[model samples]
Target: MKSIVILIFFLSSIIGLGQDYIFLESKNGFREIKLGTSVENYPEFNRKDNSNAELFKLSLNSKADYVYVGSNDDKIKTAKILFIYLTTNNNVISEIKVVTEKVLNVYAILNSAYGEPSSKHGDKWIWKTNNIECSIEGDQNTIPGYHIVYKDISNERIELKKMKLESTKKAQAEL
Candidate 1:
């Protein structure tokens, strides 16, 4: 057991483990994008169009507060980023969803960007801060590649509160 544990650590170190790029992002938003900023700053990304794929139908543009924006030309590090979805809260970016190509070196690239994951569960690796939560996991259900979610914790809380209030209102409406 001891040998197995040591071996795992050794391999992780060799695979590149460190919080090298932790200071580069503003609360875990994508690349130069930020969590609390208005989406108007990024005119490069437009509202995701109507598409037939399950991965493409994730946007909730109908909601007054939440919106998903994407661009076909976005890339994580080098190239071949399959999908990039940015979910916004009242026009402020709150979450990011990325699905990379199957052959991409996802682990290494993600490690370089967010440093080593704070924790790992099954195939999912999560990195958390006081205000941001980021995770990347392998999903075969929608795509045969990686699915990454980077979100703002505070905005998430706000959304959750709104949902709870709505739930309460609905329950009282039937009373």
Candidate 2:
């Protein structure tokens, strides 16, 4: 009984350590984006026409990189719809989000690539590693859209977000 208890505690600690972030196991990102790649180092992919092109184009204002690849009949022409890279510590690509129309197809691909998910709720499935959290979710509407997100653990990002939240609250309080 004591041996079993020790084993259980050891396993739990390992699991806890794996869940430290949302994108820890993300080795690939939208064709060539790749996780853990520095923004300045990633190559520029060919952009194509797509329904979400405009939306991704607009998102470029805030993100380090936003590229759109066209789609036809809900199938991405380039196998990817959009590639978004968020700037974090040292201007590296800390977060990546890919949008697609084939939710199940992408989910299957991710499952095979990342193994079993840690948790799943409805349309969203989450996989965690020591430094990354990977998530896939889709909408329920007539024209459902799927999103694959990879987030890395970055202290700079957390601090920046905290500062933004504080500023927003301070402004609201003054108003």
Candidate 3:
């Protein structure tokens, strides 16, 4: 009886460890796709029309720095992209935009894991544009979500809020 009870408890514990997030990656890094039921029908980048839309679907293990949206042209011109951070509901959230030529696809960089050393240690995500370089520390809040902080080369900081799953779903549906 004792062994049976212990085995049951262990099994229960393992089952309780349900997936909380999802990551979408393809060699280069993370991609910007939408998770959930609604957006799962669409392809990575539907070439039906002249749309440059791509969705970064999140599951129970998705994280990244940016979401790339490339063009279908050989040069990959006319790209529209954005940066994304994981949200509490396992969604990618960001406000950064990208407009480039010769675009192929976009990916995300798993900055750090929750409660990990990199997340708790020093700056997690760092970016530089033009002539500026910046670093951001992800130790400000204790929330279990992705926090996107943008720092220019000059050391200035910009904090982007968390991305929610419901909102992400809606956005993906529109796309």
Candidate 4:
């Protein structure tokens, strides 16, 4: 029993060390693209059709059609919204939201990387550190969701938008 516990602890620690590139942390950006990256770097693809300076989308060379980017920091710390969405201000990511069908895979990976979650509310699970707050929502019958929210946060407008989105979802669910 002690050996099994030790093994689990050892494996978990190894996974924890790689959190910098995990789904939540990478919400800042993906692959070569990262928060604070210059828009000019992606010269190969044109700016999305319905994008502006603050909130925009970028077409990437991947299975996903486009990645959403939102900046409340004057395009400084721009947040890249993939399966995990982020909001930023003054060039730092402040929050993240991830929704996907791969609940078990995501949960196992996050648990290994960040340890146990900090709280739980219904189908949602939350993990908070000094620097960030992350949450996962959904259940077996619905889509799985995840989020990484920053603390002493920045970008009120983005927060409002997030709230509106959640409200819409809740209203829909009720009906």
User: TM-scores of the models, in the given order?
Assistant: 0.59, 0.54, 0.18, 0.39
lDDT of 3 by residue, 1-175 (tens): 9999999998775544322111111111122323222222324432222242223333311433233344444121233323332221222222222222222221132223211112233534443332222233323344223333321212123222223556678899999
* lDDT per residue (tens digit) for residues 13-126 in model 2: 776645323234445454565666766665453322364345544332245344434445334343456444344456566677666656456777777666778899886898
Q: Give a tens-digit lDDT track for model 4, residues 1-175.
A: 9999999998886576455424545444333444444444444333323553222332111222223433333121222233434343443433333334433565565566667776788876666543345655555454423333333222445687899999999999999
Local lDDT at 149 for model 3: 36
Segments of candidate 4 deviating more than 4 angstroms: 1-84, 90-92, 140-175
lDDT, candidate 1, 79-151, per-residue tens: 4566566677678877777666665577777777777778999778887765688888764455455777777
**Model 2, C-alpha of 71: deviation from truth (Å):** 7.9
Model 1 ranges with Cα > 4 A deviation: 1-21, 24-27, 48-55, 58-74, 77-79, 139-142, 155-175
RMSD of each predicted structure = 11.3, 8.5, 20.4, 14.7
User: Which model is ahead, 1 or 4, in terms of lDDT?
Assistant: 1
Prediction 3 TM-score vs. true: 0.18
Q: Which regions of candidate 3 fall more than 4 Å away from where they truly are?
A: 2-34, 40-48, 53-113, 117-175
- Off-target runs (Cα >4 Å) in candidate 2 are 1-32, 45-53, 57-65, 68-90, 142-144, 154-175
Report the C-alpha displacement of residue 113, candidate 3, in angstroms.
7.2
Cα-based lDDT for every prediction: 0.65, 0.60, 0.31, 0.46
